[model samples]
Target: MIPGMFDYFAPSTLEEATRLLEQHGPDAKLLAGGHSLIPLMKLRLAAPRVLVDLNGVAGLAGIEERDGHLRIGAMTRHAQLEASELISDRYPLIADAAAVIADPLVRNRGTIGGSLAHADPAGDLASVMTALRAELVVVGPRRERTIPIDDFLVGLFTTALEPNEVLSEVRVPSPNGGSGGAYVKLERKVGDFATVAIAVQLTVRDGTCDEAGIALTSVGPTNLRARQAEDSLRGGSLDEQSLRAAADLAAQEAQPAADLRGSEEYKRDMVRVLTLRALRRALERATR
Candidate 1:
């Protein structure tokens, strides 16, 4: 597939990128890993007249833990996240999703910022970010601001970012003792998007849930937090019945669409099953 002819600009600095975007406005698309934009462009589903490539923009890749939070540059690739010892040790939920984002080649080329900004409902990272209550730092020509994951994701292929803004960084808090997180996905093939997936972060203390975060993927117009399910798990001993109840609530909150993957009911069922599995796995990895 080939994309339409367009003017290409590979800006080496963020300020330059922003300037290009501000100048081009809605006619321009920022190219990160090019995984999402390129595909859409090739399909003619997107036709930006200007391509503002961010690939050459330095200082937008890497993972660093600082000030009790792990800060990830937007240009960081999935392969890097999957290979990072620091990410594996501190935020396995990220590493877990990174490992399965696509095959090795795709993983090497996919960037977290691109995926998040694309805001595909079926993508795994949005749910994981929501589950962790992560924040994104967005920069524009006028100002900079932080957006919570829930607020950042508005709908399918939509976000709060202005056309002139760029997502610069992702920030996640350090997990305390007894805190554990994991992501579980069900895909039809090795590189397919998830049919139904779940991301969970749970904190336990004295055999009871101290905190819980649950989010579902490919289950609604946008990836969403399962707040009722999360509330159901809090202050309870994570036993068979409690887990089942919480998992069931997650399914109830889901609004999955029927596609070739399966029926809506089947997807809801998968949500229940995967939610339970993810919670169990996260619990087993719980620290303290």
Candidate 2:
């Protein structure tokens, strides 16, 4: 179905876009890559009276290195992220997750900010960002604010962003010493949404886990940081026994729901299995 009729405004700058949103209020929607929003609009779930296209906005599409973090423009496409040498070298988990989002066609058009703003529980980027503890920069009529990834996602298809705010960039801290990360998902088919997804980041020192971050997706109302699992690994050697115990805690902490993709029980099981596999792979990479 076609989207409802709406006034289209392509703004050349973020200030203009935010002004449009302020003017239109709840009746306005910001259009980025439109991979996610357009579908909702076409389905009539979202019928904004005005579409503030951000494509024309300058300075919203690039990857840059700052003092100690990689700052990705909100409009940066998944395909771009996959192709970024910086990301591949320092944040391989992000690159891996980007490569697995839908198919090539979707990745070519989908924006990272769009994905995070949409806050889809099944989205790969959300879980990866959660595990990475990424920061989101948002601008609004009042002022600009930085939101932690954990606080940014409030619920399924929901976020902490105010209606008049636009997500400007995502900031990922550079990987610490001896750190490696990986994302693993169990999909029914290629390019399908994950039935269960896991992201693991480990900082190992002398064969002992100095730090660990774990997140699970598509198994809860929101992407969940596996705090219990991470806590289990910290200060311990990632031996087979400890890994198994952490995996069990990860599964226990999951709050999956019964859905068409899989039952909650099955999803919980996948969380356990995938968490173990991802952690093992991440550990191997860190060692190497």
Candidate 3:
């Protein structure tokens, strides 16, 4: 389907882009690897008068280690992350989610910033970023500010970014030397959105759980932190019984709606199952 008539601007510089955005305000939409926005435009679900294409901006497309963290450019594609040695070696959880996002073709073109800005409750990256404690760097008219992952995403299809802001980078804190992470998802089919998705990061030391980061996707209005579950595992052995107890607490926080994915009750149960599975695998990787 063709989109409605709209003016397009591809500014080669960041300053120029921000000025354009400030001029156009809410009527303008930033187009960054347009896999998400293009579909919405085709459906007429989004009808912005101006499309400010970010492709021309040079600095927004790479991954590098900076200040003891992985600083990923907002424009980096999912396929890039999936194949990156930096991600595979240090953050397998990110690689796992990136490899399974949409499909090969979609991953080839989908940008990290676009997905994060899209803020779809079911997207794999949002939940993974939450568990990883990632921070979003957004640039606006007067200044650039960093927002933590959980604070950046406010609700479904919404974010804390103002209309004139551009997400420039995503900074993920480096995991401790003995820590590891995992992502587990239950999709109806190979390419479908997850029925229940779980992301976990565990830091184990001397046969005890040091820290845990747990998050849920597709079961609420936003990507949710499993704080209760995380707290339960801290300072305890991550054995079967402890995992079961944490999973139960995580499941209790779910507010899923009945849909084609499954009944509400069914998804809640899967939350328990997947949470346990994700934590176990995460612990194995960390302990090795």
Candidate 4:
């Protein structure tokens, strides 16, 4: 299906792009990788009057570590993340997600900023970012600001991005020697969206859990934070019993509806299994 007719603009700078977005208002859509928006447009789910292309904008793509944070340019490709030594050595959780998001074709062209901005509940990157408690930097015509990933994601297919704003970067605290993370997903097949997925990040210090983050995907209106599960692990020993309890809490927290992937009961149960697996992997990485 062909997308509806729309005017296209290739802005050389972010400032110019934002100005175009502001001028076009809600009818303007920014083109990043176009994986999300183009499909919607083809299905007629989205019909914007103007398309503002960001490909020409410089300085919107890179990966760097500075000021105690790992900064990923919004336009950074998933393949880049998957292949980065820095990400693989320090933040393997991100690499895990990037390596499995859709397939090679999608990863080759898809952008981190585009994925998060799309805010699809099933998007692998959203849950990963949530588990990392990453910060999102957005720029608009008037100002630039940072929003926590939790707040940036509002609901299904929704985000906190204003019409005139562009997501500029994602910032995550650099992992210490004791910190580790993992992403565990259950899909029907290769490149399929997750039937149930879990992302876990853990910081272990002196045989105790110093920090923990647990988030779920494809089981709620948004990427669901397993707060109770995280709280259960924090400041506690990662014993079999504690891990089981946290897994149970995460399953309980999921709000899955019956779908083609599986029944609600089935998915909830899978959440328990996956969460336990992910936690175990994360703890091993943290301690080893």
Candidate 1 lDDT tens digits, 1-288: 788989999999999999999999999999998888888999999999999998999999989999988899999998999999998987889889998897898889989999899999998889989999999999998899999999999998999999999999999888878889999999999888999999999999999999999999999999989999999999999998998999999999999999999999999999999999999999988843
lDDT of 2 at 108: 92
- Expressed as tens digits, the lDDT of each residue in 1-288 for candidate 2 is 899999999999999999999999999999988998999999999999999999899999999888899899999999999999998888888987998899998999999999999999899999998888899999998799999998899998999999999999999888778989999988889999999999998899988999888999898889999899999999999899998899999999999999899888988999999999999888888888
- What is the alpha-carbon lDDT for the whole of candidate 2? 0.92
Clashes of each: 1, 0, 0, 0
RMSD of each: 1.0, 1.0, 1.0, 0.6
Per-residue lDDT for 131-239 in model 3, tens only? 9899999999899999999889999899999998999999999886888999999998887788999999988888898888999999999889999999999999988
In model 2, the number of clashes is: 0
Question: If both were scored by TM-score, which would come out higher, candidate 2 or candidate 4?
Answer: 4
TM-scores for every candidate against the unseen true structure: 0.98, 0.98, 0.98, 0.99
Distance from true location, Cα of 45 in model 1, Å: 1.1
TM-score-wise, the better of 1 and 4 is 4
| Candidate 1 residue runs with Cα over 4 Å from true position | none
Give the clashing residue pairs of candidate 2, or none.
Answer: none
Model 1: weakest 10-residue lDDT segment is: 279-288
Q: Whose lDDT is greatest here?
A: 4
Candidate 4 lDDT by residue in tens digits, 1-288 = 999999999999999999999999999999999998999999999999999999899999999999999999999999999999999999989998998899999999999999999998999999999999999999999999999999999999999999999999999989877988999999999999999999999999999999999999999999999999999999999899999999999999999989999999999999999999999999889988
